[model samples]
Target: MFKYLKNDLPASIVVFFVALPLCLGIALASGAPLFSGLIAGIVGGIVVGALSGSQIGVSGPAAGLAAIVLTAIGALGSYENFLVAVVLGGVIQVIFGVLKAGVIGYYFPSSVIKGMLTGIGIIIILKQIPHFFGYDADPEGDFAFTQVDGENTFSEILNSFKQISLGSTLVAVIGLAILILWEKVLSKKAKIFQLIQGPLVAVVFGIIFYIMFGSTDTFAIKTENLVSVPIPEDASSFLAQFSFPNFEVITRGDVLLTAFTIALVASLETLLCVEATDKLDPQKRVTPTNRELFAQGTGNIISGMIGGLPITQVIVRSSANIQSGGKTKMSAIIHGFFLLISVILIPRLLNKIPLSVLASILLLVGYKLAKPSTFKAMYAAGWKQFVPFIVTIVGIVMTDLLVGIGLGLGVGIVVILYKSYQNSHFLHIEDKSNGVHKIKMTLAEEVTFFNKGAILKELDSLPKDTHLTLDVRKTRYLDNDILEILDDFREKAKQRQIHITLLSERGEVENPDSYIEFFRLRPKTA
Candidate 1:
């Protein structure tokens, strides 16, 4: 980890800049105190990063859980009460890790995972459009189908256009331009360009723009649009922000339900982020999923206990971490430290940063995730891969993340079953010396219940009076459904005057009188 300092340090700074606005935005969206999100980011980075087995995975407050957190808080009647559920959620995730349930991440098909990333990328871009224009009615944090403010995603975009702030819009445009030039032009010029990240450059320019515009009396742009970092004059003042959970609410049934919701969603999100991070790693290192779960769970437990929002392996921060040249876990750890130090030392300085600048950074991140090349590449792979990929993309775009994945998984399963049925057997007819037609049916390596229909159809369609050979040597296992098919075929063989030969591991049997009795007979001694 230390060996990656040169790369990781720079990457940590980039991730720090990317994470700051999101931390505040998500907290604002959840209706939680603004400081809670920062607390989660700090804990997610330092605590989770220290414990996690992943080299590239980064943890922080997640937008995916914003809806749940909002509802849970309202249902529980107090923010402190909601914290109890978060702690319990962490404990439950630890249990999941102990049970080795993290393998669930592996079951997701590659197409669906890619589709998920692309969908999230598109959603991020759409959600940030309002913030870029300085429209702040909805929480900058929510990314779900329905927002805390009761507006749908499209409605928010339409509303943004109507209430756009000219000053904020101008700043956003300039910030975006700077980021683009830094990435496409400046970053390629020399070694220094490669060393400094585009986000840092945009952020610096953003502060300058804010100061220049802030002094003007004619500008309609409000200073509130800039990042608002809580300024604590002393240690006690800073500690005043901390809030503890009301453990008295622990016995409530609603509290338990909320805990389960957080645990399930947070665990799933963390697993997906881990998988995505592994894919992004230049070295292609595999993370220990169970360990990741344990780390996230521990981080959440600590974060929730101290007034922080729940933490998970967030893809936005992780993606930014990777794109900025983060090489190891150290980058993640250092970013958390940066979060901690920034809030304590120079929060006013942080407040000078503009949301539009951060929006510009996120726009770049979002574009990278849903690039046109991604779609073209998926299409080039063929329809089998592209269909589910597109389905997932559309589903996520129209609905939310989990729902879209469910739809994609349903389609993916159908594709798998269809392929299985198609490859279940080999059917051919041979004419023998005596003009007898020999029909051969070779079963697949493992015949399951899914293959029942295909095998039955092939057996029933065999020409009458033909000599049939059923080969089971290559088959390692036969499901009961296929076994029953063989039994029925044996019964019909005699009536159709068909000579049936059953071939097994032992040897060939000229006539299998009863399918059940044929299996009962032992092999003859050599």
Candidate 2:
């Protein structure tokens, strides 16, 4: 993992920038001490990153879990007791990993996975718009359309235009221009440009710009619009920030229930991030999901013991890492160390960097994820994939991450069911004489209730003078529902003056026997 330091170090800086505001924002949203988010960030990066089998996935506090964390803390009576639940949650997650529950990530359709990435990309772009304009009210990590601050995504963006910060707007535009030039031109021209990422350059430029413009009336960004890492007044205050979990609370029934909830939710969320990261990986490497869960569990355990929020693999940070050219887990590991060292030593320096510059970095990442070419490519892949992909993007945009994913999955399942219903038979129609037709219906290898509607519709459309043949020789399984439909259709055929013949593995019958007995379907074979 350390072998990719050249790429990893630069990428880590980008992720560190992305993770910083999110760490604080999620902690703030969860009603926890602001420093706890930093603690989680450190543990997620160092502990989880070191242990994970994923090449590009980065772990940290998740906005999706904020509500749960908030309620759990209040329900548990104290933050220390809440930490006990977190530790127990980590233990439960470890058991889930041991049971190989990570396999569930594999079951997500590829379309849904692509949709997730695209949706997240769109979200990043939307969320960063306000920050890009130097709007400081909404937190950096709130991805939901309806923010915790009670403003919708688009409205916040509209409001940003009214409260524009002059220095921030200028820095953002210049920072974006530099990033675009560095990536699109300089990087291709020289290897040095690739090693020194655009984001790193943009951030340094932002810092200098902040310093240079402070005395000028037309420039100088505000303290609220800059990166804020909590600064401890003294060494003793810094030491007091870490609060140990109360292990005695582990025996409480409510604590155990909350632990199960966190384990379940955190495990599911981590699995999703793992899947998204694997898809986003340029090399198309498959991460070991179980190892990922184990690493997350370990991270959470450490985080809780040290006054941090519970941790999970986060797609935003992971995607930021990937988009910034991270090639291995080393980027994630280094970013965690960056978080640790930054808080301890360079909190004031970090506080000088403008959020608008970081917003510019993420805007490019967002554009890359939801590029127009990606949309066209997905559209060309056929509706089965395209529909779900589009739906996922829309769903994620309209709601939050998991709900959007769930919506896309729902659409994907409908597509599967529709396809399954239409694929159970081949129908051949031929006009043999005046007002007479010969029709052949060949059953598929596996026929079930899903095929009942298609078969019945075809059978009902046969003309009075038609001679129909039902071929079941290739059919291995037939649902009772289809058999009943066939039985009803045969009686209707008699009334319509239609001639019917049945052919099966057993023998030929001129519609003289029970449809069920004649078909002789064994569902087990299917």
**How far is 418's C-alpha from truth in model 1 (Å)?**
1.4
Worst 10 residues of 1 by lDDT: 517-526
For residues 181-220, write the lDDT of model 2, one tens digit per residue: 9988999998999988888889999999988994478886
Q: List the pairs of residues colliding in candidate 2.
A: none
Clash totals, every prediction: 0, 0
What is candidate 2's CA lDDT for residue 261?
Answer: 94
* Each model's Cα RMSD: 2.5, 2.6
Give the winner by TM-score: 1
Candidate 2 wrongly placed segments (more than 4 Å): 251-254, 434-436, 464-466, 487-501, 504-512, 518-526
